[model samples]
Target: MHPRAGQTKKRTRIQAKNEAKILEAALDIFATFGFRGTTIDQIAQKAEMSKPNLLYYFRRKEDIYISVLERTLDEWLTPLTELDPDGDPIEEIGKYTSLKLKMSQNDPTASRLFANEILHGAPMIEHVLKGSLKNLVDEKAAVIHHWVKAGKLTKVDPYHLIFMIWATTQHYADFKIQMRAILGDDVDQPDYYEKAGQTISTVFFEGIKPR
Candidate 1:
């Protein structure tokens, strides 16, 4: 049987630190190479540890991949989970869009990692997407629909709107190379992201304003 997580009794601080190092290294390798392209050897090298030592914490590459995906999904969805229904709908959504844009700028690797998984049909995380992600989106969509009914937002499909926000925000990270090449050094300017967030929020909320 596969070893259960935390099966080992009372891990020490050094073990915890080493485990974190291994997982962080795994994220970089997996994001760069994708799961099929990455290997335990590469992860071990990235972590600056021997393969045998790395295997002590995670016996297989699959375990490390799953752990990274779980953590990434938790972080990626935090802004969405924090959206407040009690706030002004436009402001709430604008803040969410801004937060996503900031994440795209600050954590492009994580964004691309998630995108890569989705591009490959999410073999490693389809269950989480279909279950936890879907449930969360459904709950938020209800809130959006309520806003629409109350004349706060225009009558638009909330799910599609959510998808649009995700795609637009994530584009900055997944396509940063293309963006940088096209825009030159201007892409590196902080104002570029601020303008992007402002533009995206303006266009979206304005387009969906009650008519």
Candidate 2:
């Protein structure tokens, strides 16, 4: 029988550790080679597990890849879900931008993985995107739309605004090499996220604020 996650039996703790190790290795391999380019053998080798042993946990490579992606997508979009409708829109957007830029710098591999998914039309996350994602955006856009209608903010395309935020924040991840080249190696420093996040928050909040 499958053991409870936290209630690991003698064999289960080791099993859980192995699964985490495998997932970590898989992240690095899949981030570098992408889901289509990676192989079960390569992942097994990276995780230092036998092919059959890895298979004991994950039935297929797709299962592992999808599981990794599910986690990544969940994290990638979490900031948006935290936005409060009653909060000041500027602060809300600023905070979201900061959170996203921080993620871009902190977990670049995960970002690239998600990017690859979207680049391929998000086949794995298409349902989530069309469902939970659309619902959140639709709700948030209405909030922004209401602000504009109430003269609290300048009129802007709510969907486009969201798209812009996503594209801008994710640029640091999706185009890290180019960003590093253009922004220089300081972009990789420990405080880089703080400085970058502040700048993004400034640019977006200032540009979007009403007169």
Predicted model with the maximum TM-score: 1
- Lowest summed lDDT window (length 10), candidate 1: 1-10
lDDT (C-alpha) at residue 5 in model 2: 32
The true-versus-predicted C-alpha distance at residue 177 of model 2, in Å, is 1.2
Regions of candidate 1 where Cα sits further than 4 Å from its true position = 1-8, 207-211
Clashing pairs in 1: none
Which tens-of-lDDT digit does each residue in 84-135 have in candidate 1?
9899998898889889999999998899899889999999999998898999
What's the distance in Å from true for residue 19, model 2? 1.9
- Candidate maximizing lDDT: 1
RMSD of model 2 against the true structure: 3.6
The C-alpha RMSD in Å for every predicted model, in order, reads: 2.8, 3.6
- What TM-score number comes out for model 2? 0.86
For model 2, residues 17-70, the per-residue Cα lDDT tens digits are 988888888887888788899999999999999998898778789888987877
What stretches of model 2 exceed 4 Å from their correct place? 1-11, 208-211
